[model samples]
Structures are given as structure tokens and as C-alpha cells.
Target chain A: MADHEIVIAGFGGQGLLFAGKVLAYAGLLEGRELSWLPSYGPEMRGGTANCNVILSDTPVGSPIVQHPNVLVVMNAPSLDKYEPLVAPGGKIFVDSTLVTRKVERTDVDVFYVPATQMAADRGMHDLANMVLLGTVLRETGCVGEETIDEALRHVIPARKAHLFDANKAAIEAGKGYVSAA
Target chain B: MKEKVLMKGNEAIAEAAILAGCRHYFGYPITPQTEVAAYMAKKMPKIGGTFLQAESEIAAINMVYGVASTGKPSMTSSSSPGISLKCEGISYLAGADLPALIVDVQRGGPGLGGIQPSQSDYFLATRGPGHGDFHVLVFAPASVQEMADLTGRALHLAWKYRMPAMLLADGTMGQMMEPVELPEEHEAFGTDNPWAAVGTGMKRPHNIINSLELSPERLEEKNVERFERYAEIEKNECAWEEYRMEDAEICIVSYGITARISRNAIVAARAEGIKVGMIRPITLWPFPAEPLLAAADKVDSFLCVELNMGQMKDDLELAIRCRKPVDLCYRVGGMIPTSDEVLDHIRALAEGGR
Candidate 1:
């Protein structure tokens, strides 16, 4: 692809920004131009949060992805806000457990994943973001699995290095979830 | 140490300042630009430097004035309202000929505007951020990497010219994240100037630094000398970038975040054979008037995009002497104009649909 714009949105504690950062880093590792912009608002913590991630062979013009080719929404509010903005023939990954309403656009491809439920089943309650990331990787092929793995190694802070293996497992399980479906 | 890493624009600017040998940082907390101070607070002490959270923006700017008078690189940053509070100190710094760096990561406002990205401070920065007929070298960075790069350049130019410099950025540039290569670390600028206020100790007379000259004639003389230096800077330091201008019929003029969006619109317009180009001013103070004047001879018309009510458009009109029709496309407050919206305007202008 010449360029790919993605927006990941959810509540504040959902790691939406982190997922975007990881993807941006992966694009950097692949030597593509990339930008990651996080939403800044008054109510940060329990408030709605979103981030725009752009990957391009050419330099990215605006970091704000007004119309994204791919949107990953983890909550109902995010789905409501971003669903109408998805480009035609775009791909949307909706976390079915949190976002109950089906996507309304027929021109775009919508994939429903039980990210929260899958994380719960795997006993990793807060890994839904990673699951969605893996599903995005499988659907979009925007970043290689090796790049995502390498990016994860660098992105996980040294203080939280112990969680790297578990996060890797979550990613694999997420990709497996899609293949099985 | 990794040379490239994902970094926020605000944090990148702080890291770049540290690398540029700016050991003294004084700032107050404000929205959209608090990260610059937070980064300095966390890292300055670890690097054996000073980071003071002053009581107010005015105090922070005065602290910068003191540190810079000693010939060491020092800086303070704020949002639009807080920067307004620092105007007096900025004028004092200019009057005393002390070099310092001031960053204004702008938000919307004539008064405590929203903490969203805005380029409304263009006139304030380029036309004289402070009073007393002085000009601060203003650099408008369009990207996160340029935020880091220009912070270093801004202080360097300030030190070279013995004048205050300002990095004109916005909330988007400060909050966004991208890969940046941090500058190599350097020692703090040496405090060994003949004009420094350091105690003489019977070694050549004492050097006194003060902005109060009292005499109208003396102040006028000082202003004349300062304007001379500014003229030299206007001749030498103006920087800009031209994109797709070789065969362009219409040229778009912009800077900062608006320039980033214009680049996308120009690219899209090109694919549709609209023949659009861009001129992005990097140095807002030493505004690149000459190239723009030359481009007026080539392009049919000019479209100026800004995040404010067409402030920079006046600068473009003044530059090209109103020889070409200069159209304005802008949005006020903190709303960013979308690329598609800009493209629509460009398409209209191209097809004579305007």
C-alpha cells in the first residue's frame, strides 16, 4: 500500500494509545514513514481516548487521520464516534464484547472479535488491546508478525519486561482466534 | 544508545534542549505544553542541571532572563495565555541583549482558549512577541522531528545573535508522537562573556546588565542597533521549503501544522492534475519573502492556509506585493482543517470554481 491510516479508539484505560505506538514502531522497523498521535482531552483517565496511526512509503502529511482506512474500536462510544468515518472498502475490527451494535456500513469489511471474552478465557483480562492488534495484523497485513514481535520487545518498558512473554502469547492467541473463526 | 525512538514532540524538544547545552530551565505548568516542563523537571536534575517550577509564567521568564544574562543557554515554555504573561520579561531580555529560548506551544485563544492546536499566535510571534519594537527569531516547526531539531537551532541562533528566540509550535506538534534522532549532548554554553554580570574581582571593570536606559535618546539608539542586527538576520536566516513548484500554476503558502495538511492536499491535487505546489516557511521572523516574490512570477494565484483567521495571509500579500491574487483558507479557534477540505478549495481554485 502507498499509505495506510488507522485509528484505534476506546476508553482511557484500554491501551489504545499503546497499541498505536506499537504499530508505529513496527512501521519504523520496516523503514516506513509513520506517525502516532494520541487524543488529549480534559478527562483523561476514564474518559474517551483515541490515537491515529499512519504508515506510508512517503512522509505522512497530517498525523490526524480524519478518514481512516482501518478503525479498531474497543468500546461502544468509540464505535459510535468512528463508525461513520471509516472509508469505503475499509476494514473495521470491532470488539464484540464491549461494542454490541453491528457496524452499519456495507461498503466496508467489518470483523467482529470477542477480544474481551477471549482475553478472559485466556486468563489475561487486560490483553484485549493486543488481541485486537493481532487481529488487525492478520486482516490488514500492515505489519509483519516478526516486526510486531520485535517492536513489542522494544516497546515493553524494562520495568515491565516480565510481561513480554505473556503479551506475545496473547498476540499468538489472537491471531489463532481469527484463523479458527 | 538508540539514535531513533518514538517520542512525543514536547519531550523531544526538552531532550533536544538538553543536548544543545541548555542546563537552566524555568517554567510553569500549562496545558498542551506542560510536558516540556515535566520532561525538564525529570531529567535536568539527573543531568546535574537546574529545573525550577516557578510560581507563575512571569516568574519563569524572568528566571530565564537571569540565567541567560550569565551567558548560559536557558529556556522557558508555555501556552498562549501563559506566553502573554511572559511578554514583559521577553521585552526585558531583548532590551538587555540577553540570549534565551522561549517556546510557545499555542492553543486557541484571545483569552485562555481551548487546549487544542492553534496557529493564531503567528502575528504575536513574528510581529514582535514582546513590546519595545523588538523581534524574536521565530521558528515554525511542522513535524515532531523538526520540533527537536529547531529547538536546538533556535537556542544556537539566540546565542549567536544575543537576542531572544522563540519556537512557534502548537498543541498538535507538542502532543503528537513520531520517531526522532536526539542531538548529541554538549556542555552548557560557557559563562565567559565580557558583558556578563559576574563579579569583576578587580579583573577589568565590572560588567553591568540592565534594560533601563532612562534617556529617550539612548533607548532610541539601542533600538536602532537592535534593528540593524534584525536586518542582518532577515537577510541571512530566512528558511523555507518549496514542494512541487517547478511546473505549478497555483501555490499554497503555510507553516506549522497547517503546512503538514497542505502537503497532503497538494499531493492529492497533483494526482488529479491540478498543478498545486506549496511554500512552507520554516523561519517565521526572517520570513522568506524573496523566494515567494520570485514564485509570484510563476504561479497564477496563491492560496494561504492557516489555523487562524488568515494572519499569515497578510504576510504573503506583503511579500509578493499583492502582485498575484492571494486567497485565504482558514479555520479559527482550535479546529484543524481537514486535508479533504483543503483539497476541495484547491480543486475549486484550479477549475475557476471559486
Candidate 2:
């Protein structure tokens, strides 16, 4: 069982926190210890927002992820700030639609998924975060894909149940894109 | 076994308070802790409980005092600056020997400090919240599970001791989410208070709940009696966790979120062959002196890692009676020390001893 320290960074309304929650829920469903911490306060209103998610076989220590092995950036600023902090041999998932800059690091694997463009193409303008999350899952295999449905059920409230199918479709689209690429 | 659910620390405290039979919540919203009030507002009405967004922190605490006078479980929560506004009411609760739960999700502070995690209120909480010699039962939680568990415990202990109790957390603990198995709802223990000022029902003498002892002698006696209860509390209620202490040469003293960070540092340092362990104080008021004193006889030195500028270091020094050298490693003004920073301190201590 591998441990994953994941950092998801993007604009406030980009659903980064929700993506992290989905990952955290997947970890929980598998009986792995996990923690999710977001960049809170005024920054969460409209500025840069980020969340740290850790899934460990043992009890999690320090919810703050100073060094993330799995880094996901939905924007260029997030890329510039967090790219250098990824652990060596780690994986970086970039939203190529929003962040066009190439990752400079040669020590880690980089996945450039046009998540925003892909989601928009599929009429899931708000689901780019989920698409990016799908890429992270397919690449790292940090958590099994079987837990996605149950995890989504836990996170998406009943009132928004209408969007559940779209979220699932978006994730599948992302997984399919990664496979074809 | 009860199923576990993921919840933020602030939300966990609110739900736990409800499960613990706290029917009335009076609080003013403050950052990093506003979730507590939000949860209560949504749940309290449905459960026939009262959740009032008091006009001010002062008003909120006084409302708690009113509910507490009737021997009911009541609570109020706030961040650092908001807590400062409730100091007078807190003092009144202490003077009258009222037991109520106060949750302080502390942020960086001296005056309207940044809305970031901090433990700078160590002295403000442990020494006393306001103008008095009384001590509240201060419980510091290092995890979301502890955040829920200690809330119930704090309420029970407060009612039992007839003194106020506090759940001292920071922004990190309040905002972080973790899986926790909340306690089952049950009747709160020690709810039957003989001294309560519930209407006498025309049978017994009226229970006068007042802190105004005009006579110098009577006031002195009342304070002395409270101190006696405080002594018993210190003896029986101190709570702490010791990790990897069996052969440790360097001991780390920390609590709340800082304790979690220190645990990571200790593990990393141990991997590099440093004999380091941690003594995390769960009960800040009681100070967990016995364990620190015991560790003093074993470890070469102690390091107090905190979010404040060495506030808890004073307590560590006093607890161990200066038997071993104690050092302070800290960050303030909403900045949290990273595990690497703490690891550096532990390494420096290890090398200094060598």
C-alpha cells in the first residue's frame, strides 16, 4: 500500500476542494487513514484556493502538505508555485487548457490533460476539476476506481443529485483521455 | 462498532455538543470557527434546541450564563478576538461557579490578529480567561476525533466540577477534515445540580446564584474553596499522550495542531537515528505535569513546539520544575512551523547534546 500526499491548487470556484474531498472519501472507503485541509479564509472567497489531501496506511501526521508527491494545478500561478515543491519521482497533473506553460522538472512524470477544454467539449464546464482528478487517479492508482461512485455519493448532496451523472461522465471522459494519450 | 464519517473539526464539535445534550448555543460568528455556529443554526431548530447568533461576543456569553444558571448544558464559541470580548462574562461565570462550555478556535492574536491558526492563548486559557483566580478545564484536541470526544468530556467535567470548561483549538484543527466516530447520544452525566437556581418550587430555600460576596472574609473563603476544587481537578483530570518515549533522549512538548506536526517531525528524526519523542498535552489547564516530571528524569532535554512565541514554554519549564533544559521552537502571527523546521530543531538539540 502506497501513501500519497496530494495538493490540489486552483482558483476558488474551480472545485479543487471538492476534488480533494472526492479523493479523501475514496481513501476513507478503503479504510485508509486520511486528512483534507484547505487554504481557508478570505482567499477561499475568490482568490487562490488549495487543498492538501493525504492518504496513508498508517495514521496521518500533519495535515499540512509542505511537500506533495501528487500535485494538481488548474492554473499557471498554481503551477509556478507548486511545481518546484513536488517530491522527486513524483507526478504532476496539469490542466493544459488553463495552464499552457510546460513543466520544467525532469525528475517527475507530468500529465498534461486539457481538463477544462475536455469538460467544455462534453458540456461539463463545471466538471474540469473532476476530469483532472480522473487523470490523477488513472496515473497514480493511489486509490481504486471502484470507490469513485460511492465517494461521489458521499460528496454530492441530494439536492444536486441531478449533476451526479455528469460528474461520473466527466471522470470517465478524463480516464478515457489518459488511456488514449 | 459505530460507523465513521468525515467532518471538519469545527463541525465535529457542534455535532458532539448536540449529542452531549447541549440544547442551547449562543455564539457570534468568527472565522475559522464559523462552521460551528453554522452547523448549530441548521440543526438546533430541528432538534427543539436554541441557536442564537448573539449580537456580540459579550451578549453570547451572557446568554450561556443564563442557561448555565438553570443547570442546563450550554455553550458559546469564538475565535481569538471574539473571545477577548467575552472575557467579562467568562469572569462572571467563574465567580458564580457556573459550569459552561466555551470553545475558542484560536487565530493569531494580540489584537484582531490574522485569521490563521495559533496557540497564543495558552496563558489566557490556562491561567484564567478573565479577572479571577479561578481555572477553567482547558482541553486541547490534536485531531478531529479528539475535537468531538473532548467536547463531550469537557461538558461533563464542567458540570461535575461546577466550573467553566474550554475546548482550545486553532484554525488548522478547526478547518481540517478527518474521519471520526462521533459518540452516541446519551443523557449528560452530572446534570443534577443541587446548587442550581431553578425556581425553588415553593418547597426549598431559593437558590441564589450570585458572585457578590461583599464581606472580605466570605469572598476569601469562596476563592479558597474554588482552589480546593481546582487542586482535585489537577490531580485527577490531567490528560496527555506520549509517543516513542521509551528510549528518547529529546522530548518534544506540544499540543493541538502543533502536536500533530511535531509527531511527523519526530518520526522523520527517528528515521535519521535521533532519539526523539513527544508529550502532547490534551488537558492544557491541568498541564499534565506528572508525565513531564517523569520524562525529565529520562530525557536529556525538552523542546516546546507551539504556534505562539513560547507561551507554552513557560508551562513546560514550570511543569518539569527546570529539572532538564527546555527549548522553544515556534512560529507566530498565523504562520505554522513545518515538519522540516521542527525536525531541524530536534536535530540541533540532538547534536548539541552529542
Candidate 3:
């Protein structure tokens, strides 16, 4: 059975929670068992924000992932905090535009996508989270790209439907970065 | 199967309450559980229901009492500190034999503790929600689907027994999102109570809803009658799930988020050839003592995995009649124990160590 315990962490307003929600929705659309848990309280106002997302073929036992098999870090603090906690042989997707330091771990595979810079260059300023998510999908094949597109329809409200194309573009840019590397 | 949608546990409780025929919701916002009130506020108005953000938790609970007296399903939700404020109102609802749903998405406690998850309110919900020799039916949900399913069941059982019911959840349960198939919209069960304080219209004696009985003998009688109904509920309404217990020697007793965490440990322990299983109590007030007591005869020992400092461990010992050793594995003050920690405990027990 496939079980992907993913943790996404970044500073507040970086859309980490929204990215986690999209991944959770994609898992749900595929009829897989999943759980999404966000860190709440004062930290969400302006400090670091993180969410634990699990997509499993079996029933999810605990929503809290202590050692995530897949980690996505969008900032230096997030990378510093979660890089060591990734399971051996697991995958790490880093937002290289915001995080300056190199990953010190050698037991896991790491992908550095300039998500924020790519988003800015493509005029998808706040969609860096989605770009990082796209790198995760490209490297891991955790969920299909078409499934993520369907998930966006469910997550982005009808009032904000105009940003769907931009979000998609950011994701494609993320995948393109990984391919070019 | 009905279509499933991803929803937070708190939102599931709100939508499930509406499906259970609850049209009145009164609550004050609190972290980890504010989504419940927010969801109700958004949906209730469109459904022509009453959604009032009361000035205080006390007022919100009293609103529930008022609507409940009219034989309509009503609900209120709060976190730990806010739940403390509603204790007096909950006691009043119990004294008046009112049926209402109260949700407590607990945070750390003693006084205004952190807004993170904790199971420290087990004693608060089970022992005495307020100053009274009374019991409110308590249901603990471990998943978002159970959060929705048990919300409907809690309201039904509360009205069936003419008492208040509480959904005892934690911050993690409230904040976590999972797929759930909500209950269908149906007529509210057990709403046609003869003792409702609806208008008499000059047809019969007016039904008065009051908890004030001046005479000591009558008050004692009321308490005795309530106990009799509680005894019946204990006999008929104990709900629990026994996982991999057919030949298990080590029994893990837990509920809510801790139960989910324990399941992971149990699965890992089983892989290591340790015969560990779990008995998760769904109805905490009823305690599900029958299953625990029965397991005592078969299992070598019991391990309680909880988010509090051995709160449920005492109940486990009482339920098992102290027949076997019951160890406590817990974390408190808004901290949650990882499956690795719980697995270490199980491993120790399997190795004949404390």
C-alpha cells in the first residue's frame, strides 16, 4: 500500500496550508484515505506555518506526522527545522528562491526548485507554494497532474476562478525547472 | 455509499448537527473550534435556521436550553476555557432534563492554557461538567467521519434520554480534515417529547420546564429517576471498537486522537510479533466497561494511551476491577505523544519490563 506522509512548512502568507489543501483534495478525488492537519494559533498570524498531510491506501491512523516521508520547505527556517526529520531515502522539495543554505543531509533525495523566483517571473507572485507542489509531483509521481487540475477546481472558489490558469502555469514552470535540471 | 467530501472535524460536527435536524446554533468563537461556529453561521442563515453568536459561552448554552425546552434540537460549541464558562448552563440543562448538543474541542487547561490539543478535559466532561451529581452522555470521535456520525448519534441519544450530550473532541480532532459522508437530512428523532414546554392552548395543564424543586424528597426523587435512566443507557448504549483483539494479550485502551495514534503503534508492534490491540471507547460516559472488563480476563495487561496525565487510566482500572496491570502512556499540556513513544511502551510491556 502506498502511504505518503508529507509535511509542508513555510512562513505565514506563503500559501503552505493552501498547497496542503490541494494535495489533500487530490488524494480525496482519487478515493484514497487522507488527512490534513494544520498548525494553528498565534504562529499562523505572522510566524512559521506548517501542515501535515497524509495520503494512504489504507485508513489513516494518526494525522500528525512526526517523521514525514516527504517534506516541502519554502523558507530557510522551515528547511532548517524539517530537513533532518525527513525519512531516509525520502524526498525533499526545497524552494531555492527563499532558502539560501544547502541541504546537509545525504541520505535523502532533494530537489531545489526556484519556485518563488519562477512564480515572480511568470507573474504568479503568490503561487510559489503551488510551484513547489508541482516539483513534488514531478519528482515523486505521488498524484497525477490531471488530478491536481481537477483538485484546483474544487479548492479555488468560483469567485477566484480567474487565477486557475496562473496557478496551472506556475505548476508547469515548477515541473519545467525540475526537467531542465 | 454517499458521496464523500473533505471537511475539517469541526465543520463535520456542524454540518452533521444540521442534518440531525438541529436548526438552532449558539456559540462563541474559540481557537481550534471557531470553524464550527463559522460553518454554522454561513449555512444556517441560508437554511432559515437560527445561528446566533452569543455574547458569551454562558449565554450560548442558555440559548440551547431555551430551544431544547421547546422540543427542537439546539447546539453550542466551545474550546476548553469557553466550555468551562458553559458548565453552569450545562448543569441547568441537565437539571431541567433538556436535550441539547454541546461540543467541547479541548485545548490545554487549568486556566486559559495554550490553544493546542489536549485530553485533560476527560475528568471535566465525565466526572462533573458542573456542580451536580449528574452525567451528560459523552461521545469521543477519533476521525472526521466519526465526528460527523457521532454528532448525529449524540443528539439522538440525548433526546432519547432527555439529557444533554457532549462531543468531547481535542484541538487536533477539530483542526484535522478528512473525507466524510455526512448524515442525510431527516426528521429529528425523539423530538415529540410529551414534557416539552410548548404552549398548551388551553387543552391541558401547562408543561413547565424548571429544575427548581423546593422539597429535598422531590429533588432526591428526580436524581434517582435520572440515575435509573442512566443505568438503562449503560446497559444498552455502550459503544466501542475492538481491533485485532481476537487473540491479543496486550490491550490498549484509548479514545479520540490518542486512539488513532495508538492504532499506529499497535500495527507496528504487531509486525514485531507483539500481540497488541486496542479497545477504543466511543461513548466515554457509558465508559464501555463491559468490553474492558471482559478483556481483563483474556489479555495479560492493559496499556492506556492518552493525551492527559493518566485520566482514562483510572477509569480503565476501575472498569477492569484491577484484575491486571494497566500502564499509562501519555502526554499533557497540549502535547501529543508520537507513535514511536507509544511503540516503546508496548515494546517494554512485551519484554516483561515496566
| TM-scores, one per candidate | 0.96, 0.99, 0.98
Model 2: residues with Cα > 4 Å off, grouped in runs: A179-181
DockQ of each: 0.75, 0.89, 0.89
Q: Which pairs clash (backbone N, Cα, C closer than 3 Å) in model 2?
A: none
User: Where does model 1 exceed 4 Å of error?
Assistant: A179-181, B186-191
lDDT of 1 by residue, A99-128 (tens): 888888899988888999988998988899
DockQ (model 1, Cα): 0.75
Model 2 per-residue lDDT tens digits across residues B1-354: 898899999999999999999999999999989999999999999999999999999999999999999999999999999998998999999999999999999999899989989999998999899997889999999999999999999999999899899999999999999999999997665667889888888999988888788999999999999999999999999999999999999999999999999999999999999999999999999889999999999999999999988988888898899999998999999999999999999999999999
How high is the lDDT of residue B5 in model 2?
A: 94
Candidate 3 residue runs with Cα over 4 Å from true position: A179-181
List lDDT for all candidates, in order. 0.90, 0.93, 0.92
TM-score of chain B of each: 0.97, 0.99, 0.98
DockQ of candidate 3 relative to the true structure: 0.89
lDDT of 2 at B178: 98
